[model samples]
Target: MTSEFAVELRDVVKRFVTPEGNEIAAVDHVTMQIKNGEFFSMLGSSGCGKTTSLRMIAGFEWTTEGEVYIEGNPMGHTPPFQRKVNTVFQSYALFQHMTVFQNIAFGLEMEGAKEDEIKQRVGRALEMVQLTGMERRKPKQLSGGQQQRVAVARALVKTPDVLLLDEPLGALDLKLRKEMQLELKALQQQLGITFIYVTHDQEEALTMSDRIAVMSNGRVQQIGTPVEIYERPSNKFVADFIGESNFLDGQIKSLSKDEAQVFIPALNTELRGIPISQGLVKGEDVVVSIRPEKIRITEKNAKNDNFFKAKVTNTVYIGADTHVYTESQGVKIKVLEQNHISRLDTSSFYTVGQEVGLVLMPENTLVLKKV
Candidate 1:
């Protein structure tokens, strides 16, 4: 996560002619830098051009405008095989007839490495991915997770300068996917290699990436570490896209460097928020976003700021935590609390039709200009 960028895109854009003969913009003038040895990820919904942007980096797709660079070298016109990178696709794309060893060895073989060198490299890679003894088995004989590991082994066997993974865990089941996410993070740290991962799963992105670029409408909306992105989203799109949020449409009543007061006309309350950027003025439409976990439900109104009262509408318990839905000033709000030893006061447990007070943690609330 240093200042030295491993990959840089300068106003890169990609477009394709749809069947209706209209040109569609997929990657729209995106400019970003992936730091050296950083686990950078591009995350977005389907059709947002995250995959298209990765393809351009992989040399599978060409950019209609701008330039793409890897380690300060221009990558335009370079073939995928000739680039200093390797890719692990969602399907693994392993040769069905090839044994694990063979699949891992293929890359080095194609690179013209000597026989002994290929054997040693492939064996070491198999062990690195924890698939040493499974090398003799074919892809079809292994479990989905095992085959996925083999695919990782094949990619690492090449020892490319950078690894591009396009939804590599998309096909795995939930439990397997979660396990692989941790494995991938550990492997990345152990190898100290640059990984450009592409995915739409916000949880996966937040879990594994050193930094994430949230994309929408083929444009990068925000780029930051998980904490920064979650707590200080740049705009409404990013605030809504990353996690569960309770948005209150309001008008900017006052502004300052650290905080602002938003007037919620419907609630007739001045909601305090931490402003993300400047230029907001009085009378300008704005929106304040507060995460569900930031809201606290209480039986009595405590002496504190950022407080409101709501009526309990629903309560959902998901083992370790509880989600309480309530309405305040005709605006719905959600609060999430862990069922831990300290916070459990079940005597005051909220029930439908019961009134409860809520306090939005001002430090956790984000202020965004209306879109």
Candidate 2:
């Protein structure tokens, strides 16, 4: 096992047999690597095999094919306890009878560390997770956040080379979940340990991971940095999954080096966009993706070349922001605006049934072949 990479999976495949004897592939021919001390994530919707992949790496499930390596050593048949990895589960599975201190110290004690050494390690791990004074409290006595911290502290106290977290914050409320996300990121940096995090929340994955692998239907869709995944999605699935986008199906009207023009017949307009693929020709079917917030809403008939007129169908006020939904050329477009800014001088406040124009910025509009 090398120390450079904390985890590696090569063409890992896992299958299970149903009650009727049918084979169901939970993980289908996947290969990935998580570097040492990096925050990595596997993100996808429900039943996408994200959690199944994580379990294979954590030694909770045996792979039907391929190999899993930890620190350059094959974990082909290694038992969960033998591998130098720890896991923090979504349930915050702390022992009921053990106090926070004992729970954190349990792993070290099982490893047969000296009394003094276990005390020092457990104390430091507790302090690192900011649960220093609550050592005497049992799991039932601690708040949800505090109990979750105990789970983290228990895993970290052992000083494993890799940590696997399967939606550790899934049980927490929104505010607490957000708080733990920041805390977990900071803690990973402080300890310099590889963290393999799994979550279905796109925003959480974007906010936390250094690099993310987006998976669907037991296969990886795309693996890239957050910006790359969100700004230049490889396919329609990823483009629609990462964030709110306006998807327009049109035919390629023209193509340049990196840009193209798409014609939407319903709108009777040609829209300019960024093309990420080659082999596209004139009249070929294409899909254009543009973020909702990247569009500028105008009250007057703007002279912009890419502007399209629409009627405001509804308005949604979300405390700090407002979402304006409009129908233009048979397509629904959404515009999000922060409520902090004062009334703008140009565009008037949108109202239901009012006519408005939506403009898509050139750089923000992405054009790709339909998936």
Candidate 3:
């Protein structure tokens, strides 16, 4: 029977020995399930094991311990070509000498497919990537984006049950990369095939992934949709890694089922927030986290709960949003305000040293367990 999951890693661990004779686990007992036809991403910085995990799934690297399963069958020492998966690498790995059609048809030709079948599959793959007419072009003759499409086309020509991408768009320019992100997402949805993407760019993962597994120190820190990962990070690492977070050291003064009152030592006040981490107890040290955009800055002194008087330390206008840095009770905070009103003068902008009222909404405030 076909499994609901396209891939599964059960307590998988990949260990490596450094030149210094020290053993390290590149993937440390990490477990994840990529649903069938899901656009799943493994996201992290360098040396965080995201790439190593992908290599294991692609059969390029075997797990040092545990098992990697594809469609519920254990893939123990399985060769890359024998697996029902295809990998598109960052370098595109295209044949510089071969034409696009021949490059894409390389795999089918190796499989001993009839000449007619090879042509048909290659044509369909190129058409899928919107590069039908460019089949005569060589990899060196195409633009970066076009070359990337050719790589994708080559991978798609095999019609693998699952597609593995390791930073496939990392070689493109910023503008082109952003454009391809949307295109890749759309293609995945249209094809309805499982896409397992590995990337270090947080924004890229957020832009294209249906679900993301945030990895750190060879472990999966959190797995959730972009909304859940950004809005409610599971821990301090996830909160800080996924996006910008202003953290304050605090101790839990009171706890409820969903809410908690944390006493910030820096501010000398209690702030109410949702406890995102489990197993919280009273008097436990916690980190209070809030996104810059979630903070509200008011020019008027609004006397309300969780309101604090702050002085603007710096202001940066970055086109769509203005980042205002403030200091309150020795704690620095950043607030992101959108430029909703068009203005030609500096009068509308907040100047450094200007006093402002900062409000922290309980719903947006997150209390995370200090690691």
Candidate 4:
């Protein structure tokens, strides 16, 4: 009912009966507001209901409960074609027999637009997707990325209020996928249209979305900006899912508004000044989430309160960064240290079983509820 949001889902639910005759909620009680001209994403792994939620918005599947709204109007069981939305699927579903121009113009043709209007719209669509000169080529003649562009152009030629993308970059290889992620973000900003993107890849979501809704078991776990989601995760699942984290089981020893202390039995030490999640009480079990890049590997004791002496169990020297695996008090931890110098001798590299000290900065260490 709110005009501020381009798309809104209010407590939407989608259930399906399995082959064993058991009903399950594929999308459970989902509610979100996608702003106009915003790039919002639903991110999760397989079976997390991200694609299911997108389908509900695209009208491929009806919600079992709650409501779906679009552009200040309630969309109750409206057919996909009737709604002001278009979808780009993972398969790049372009008509193989149709040339790029025809593929882009098909939607306008179906809407009964005049020949001149259709040609003008199709030309603009191709230009928007950066396939201006590929008009005469068929889908089969295009590369994977180019074919994907055709799919996007087809959807855009409809001039829908919102575009739903269901893993549109899933079929591309790593390099092309990364390139398209940035390209799509730029395109969304240029067009200023609501984009409801669904993907299981965490990196892609973080790189593209203005805000991300992380889901699991058909329920949304957290929704926030990429920085907020990564740095101040709402729970343990979020910390572990968005990026690499070194989780240490601990219990809260003291709590305060500005600081807290957690006792880790494995390290035989308590970490203090670590930021605590909301409602975290004293004496409650928690996990300390430290990113691999946040931990500093030092040869000396650093004389810091958060420093711990450990032995390196493994060392992997990748060109950009070196992954140092160490064990402190039977707790395995990983440190991602950036390579700043060129050392030709292997002696300069950290060796296995080398004694080292690991430092956990107070700000980077997060105390999260053990979910």
TM-score of each: 0.94, 0.93, 0.97, 0.96
- In Å, residue 273's CA in model 4 sits off its true spot by 0.8
Candidate 4 has a TM-score of 0.96
Q: Which runs in model 4 stand beyond 4 Å of their true positions?
A: none
* Model 3 C-alpha lDDT per residue in residues 172-267, reported as the tens digit of each score: 999999999999999999989999999999999999999999999999999999999999999989999988999989999998887788888888
1 or 3, greater by lDDT: 3
Per-model root-mean-square deviation over C-alphas: 2.2, 2.3, 1.3, 1.6
- TM-score rank order: 3, 4, 1, 2
Model 3 compared with the native: what TM-score? 0.97
| Model 4 lDDT on a 0 to 1 scale | 0.91
Give the 10-residue window scoring lowest on summed lDDT in candidate 2: 340-349
Residue pairs whose backbone atoms clash in candidate 4 = none
Q: Model 2: per-residue lDDT, tens digit, 170-208? A: 989999999899999999998888999999999899999
Q: Give candidate 1's error at residue 347 in angstroms.
A: 3.9
Whole-model alpha-carbon lDDT for candidate 3: 0.92
